[model samples]
Target: MAEGDPSYIDYEAFLDPDFSPSSFANTLVTSTNNATDTPLDLSTPLSRVLFDLQEIDTHIHALTTKSALPLLSHTQNQTAAADHILKESGTQVAAVTQGYERLQKEVVQKWEAADEARVAAENSLATVRLARAVSRCLTLGKQLESQVAEITGRSATGAATSVGVDGASPSAGRDGFRALERAAYTILSLREMFSAAAEDEEGYGLDRVKVIRTLRGEFVIPTENMIKSRAQQTINRFSLSSNSANSSNGQSSTSSGYKQARDARARLATAATTLYLLSPEPKSSTTAVDYKPELLLSTLQGYMHTAIMTSVNSLARALSQLPSMDRTLADISTRCQDIVALEASLKTLRPPPHPLLASTPTAETQAAASTNSNLLQPLLHALDTSSLPSYYWRSLASSLTSRVQEIVNRGGVSARTLRSNRDRLRIEIKECVLRASRVSATSLLAEKGRSGTDTVIVGNWEREAAVMVSSVVGPLGR
Candidate 1:
């Protein structure tokens, strides 16, 4: 609006500071600048207060009384914005209060309903248990009465009653279950109680229901005595087998022959298990669970012999094209199987001589001994002769053949005899190894001698030749 408008005042001349037309503006200027020496404009704080008071007093006089400004609905945006903020804040508070009330009421109601259901379920479980208990009591009474009648009905003079439930003889059959009538009854009662305790009022209306419907799914809680009895019976059977093995054969080196070998092994394993159980303390050995030394020895010897006998024949049959060397490799080659199989089957911590091997010696072994004597005769002549170097092969072959002949001709001997025969060959091989230009061939001869006519010899010869081939080629650069 222009300064000349009705609301605009002529205050530009007052800014000249030459004259004051208004008393309020004059008093305000004087009080404000007295000590400060600064300009006190009409708009100063003291002047503003005075002007407002003058305006108020003048209005009061003009209208007799001034009424407060009516609280108007805001036509201006600032007033409307403030009203909008207050209204939104109140609505938010109401929403929050309503949410809190709803959640609290839901939680309290849910807890009460859960408690009621729990109480009902627990009450039903208790009722079921009580009914079962009563049924159990009645069942027990009935069982006792039956037992009493059975006892009373027995004739004291001649008729004899069997133990409790079944007439199974304590002698013919084991388990002595007939004597455990009372305990059996108690078990039945407890089984019933457990069955009832597992159910709720819905399925079992006062009558005890079978909680375990499937017989296959039923629980089996064996008593300590029952477990002990079963274990003892098993143990006794094991002990019998173990004892029998000791007395059977083993008198002859081949006493536990190949025919009865399987039964022997089974009995041996069983006996070992029994002994382990009977032992006051158990060891950590894998076989300690069932290691019977005697049985183990018997089975081991039998298997060893079989292996030696079988391997020799197997190797001979397999390498049919090599028949020229068959007679040489087969005899002892196969028997080496005995030695090897004997060793393989042994699970002991030591490399002891197989008991059977020690006791029983084959015919081949006896021949080896006789051949050794003949071997000494040839060595004397061969060593002294000037043609020894060239004739070494011939001499070695002849000596080996003589040994083989002895082994074939002489029947079986003792274990000591067999070892003695091996010792002779070992010494001859060691001695001839130095004198004989063809040591590899010489060693082969020695093996053949010991192996004799047996297929085992041929097999051993083939293996030894393989090793000899390796040794010879190593130095010759072949």
Candidate 2:
């Protein structure tokens, strides 16, 4: 059969060299034409079926040719356009794939670099913070050491420390104490620095020993030295006043002596508080067990003892010669003079070290206060007689009593209140003397002859007494 035509082939005739395909095709056409002319016989079923199939096949082939004609023309027209699109698409895909690969490699590298940079920056910050903490702590420690050395040198040489522009030491007087107070306050603030610096070490490793030891060596030890130096100076001043009083003629240094003594006592209190904080437990985690700085507490007690004794001794000697009622009154009047001096000294008293720098008191501190209180008993007993209500007129005594009462009423003493007290004392003394004169005159009159001419005698006696009193009161002119 031919490829384009599904017609029966005569292979035997084809094999014969005499039979050509064109001659055979003409014979087939002649037969079809002859059959068309004589085909009135549709009587047999098989012949009828074959003839219908032949007609159906011819109709189908014609319909297929008609439908495929337009499709062929359209394909011929679009062939060049389709080939161009395919070729361009393949090139574009190759280029896009290469570009995507490059982009992926670059993105991966950049992401890795950014991550590394972030880690490095974080590490640098941590290192900087650690270095800062170390530097700050060490620097503060060095300053503390310098202060300790300054204090020790001054104490050893008996030279006053140069504080700021004042050219004075805290040991000099009230102003010196003020400087010491400021120094102590600054030292106490170091703990806060430690806390703030410690917070940065979240995952970072830090040496706990270095931190605690630095605080101990730099801050705590030097503070202890300051306390001891202050206490020693207090004792020395008390000794100087005592010696001066002993060598002077009858006059007393009780006022200045007591003032210095009281100041020393206050300083000791601050020292005790500081010591307690520095050495809280027997084995402190923040400090060394063997280096608690409690050794000087005994020295502090000695200073306090000497100071109180010096004041008491000076007062006792001054009062020993209270020969008359007036002298006793005068001594009593002057008793609060020392107290007034003490109040003035207290006005300029330095505030205690801040609690952050202060620690719990040790057994030695408690003992110091206790032993001092015990030793003060004799001084208290000696002054008991002076405080009692006496039959003799307390002209100066009343004034001094009122001065003490005013101080007590005001809760604490100040410069202003002390001045007011001095003023009131002067006024009260005058009033007391006037009242005493009246009492004396009335007694004289009662003792004399009251029946006849007693008024005249009493008047004459009072006139003479007033003259003598005026002469005695002359030296104390307003």
Task: Give the CA lDDT, 0 to 100, for residue 452 in model 1.
Answer: 24
Cα displacement (angstroms), candidate 1, residue 456, comes to 25
Estimated TM-score for each candidate: 0.24, 0.32
Q: Give the range where candidate 1 is weakest over 10 consecutive residues by summed lDDT.
A: 436-445
Q: Report how far off residue 467 is in candidate 1 (Å).
A: 25
Instruction: Show model 2 residue runs off by greater than 4 Å.
Output: 1-104, 154-179, 182-186, 197-339, 348-478
Model 2 / residue 144 / CA error / Å: 1.3
lDDT of 1 by residue, 163-188 (tens): 43555333213322222333334434
For residue 71, model 1's alpha carbon misses the true position, in angstroms, by 8.3
- lDDT score, candidate 2, position 394: 28
What residue runs in model 1 are displaced by over 4 Å at the alpha carbon? 1-48, 56-122, 133-222, 236-478
Report the lDDT tens digits of candidate 2 across residue range 1-478.
1246654533466579787757755555554455556653334544544675686677668767777878787887699789999999999999999998898789977888998999999889877776776676567666655555454434434564554445555444453343344344445545445444345543133345477565666656567566546644543342222322332222243334334444544553344334333333333233121223343334433433443344333423322222243443344323322222222332333323334333446786555434333222222233342221121222223223333344334553342333444444344445433432222111111222224321111111233223323322322234
